[model samples]
Every structure is written in C-alpha cells, then in structure tokens.
Target: MRSLRRTASTLALLGLLAIAGCGSGSGSDASTAAGGAEGVPAVLNFSAPLVGGGEFSGAAMAGRPVAFWFWAPT
Candidate 1:
C-alpha cells in the first residue's frame, strides 16, 4: 500500500539520521592520551565521590569501558 511504503521510507530515513548522529566527531582520538597508559583514554582521569564514603576514580578502570547510572533528588 502507499501508506505502508511511506511509513517504511520515513522509518528508514530516521534510522539513518540516528546512526549518523551517533558517529564520532572530528576531535582528538580518545583511545590515546599524553600522560595516560597506552591505549587508555584521558576521560579515565576522573574522580567522583561515592555515595557511602571514599571516592571513585576512573583511572582505576583504565582501558575498560565505563558506564554510569546517576540518580539525583528532584
């Protein structure tokens, strides 16, 4: 049907746009840093306070993928 074809085309175009938006930008490569270990990103050089006590340092997890789950009071 014409309606089905139009819907499919719109979905395809949106998918392509989403993929393009996720692509890396023309910036410095994150896999290499001047003062960091080889293959480690400068983004790993961060420190954040833990909920209980102490601190969390991203440097402790260098060369590994990091995921954050942040919850703030509304």
Candidate 2:
C-alpha cells in the first residue's frame, strides 16, 4: 500500500512537470507572435498611390512625417 502511494506521487509529479513544459512552450509562441523575438516592429502592408500623386518627383515627402486622410470611393 505504501509503495503504491509512492508510485502515485511520482507519477503526479511527472505529470505536473510535463504540463509546465507545455505551458512554457505556449508562452514562447505568444512572445514570438507579439513582434518577432523583441525590439523589432512587425511589418505592415499599405496600398498606394500613397496620399499623393503618380509622379516620382523629388517634391514628395519621403523622409518627413505626413498625415494621410483616407476617403472611401463609394
């Protein structure tokens, strides 16, 4: 009876350790999805004609902060 109790306790400990390991893997996956490994911004896609015109002239605000006002064509 005592040996059976000891075996049950050992199995319970092993099961807890396995659960902890699985939980840690999920946390790491969440961290990776939350913006790569860290210190990196997620890439975003933007459609264009980009708040300006078709001309690639030097008159465009390339390196400057520009406010974009979008309107639905409907």
How many Å off is the CA of 26 in candidate 2? Answer: 8.0
Model 2 agreement with the true structure over 1-74: per-residue lDDT tens digits? 99999999999999997887776343222212263334222221133453456633222433343445657577
Cα miss at 70, model 2 (Å)?
59
Considering summed lDDT, which 10 consecutive residues are worst modelled in model 1?
Answer: 24-33
Q: Runs in model 2 with CA error above 4 Å?
A: 24-74
| Per-prediction CA RMSD (Å) | 7.5, 19.4
- Sliding window of 10 residues with minimal summed lDDT for model 2: 37-46
lDDT of 1 by residue, 23-67 (tens): 777544667558866666777767788878899877787645556
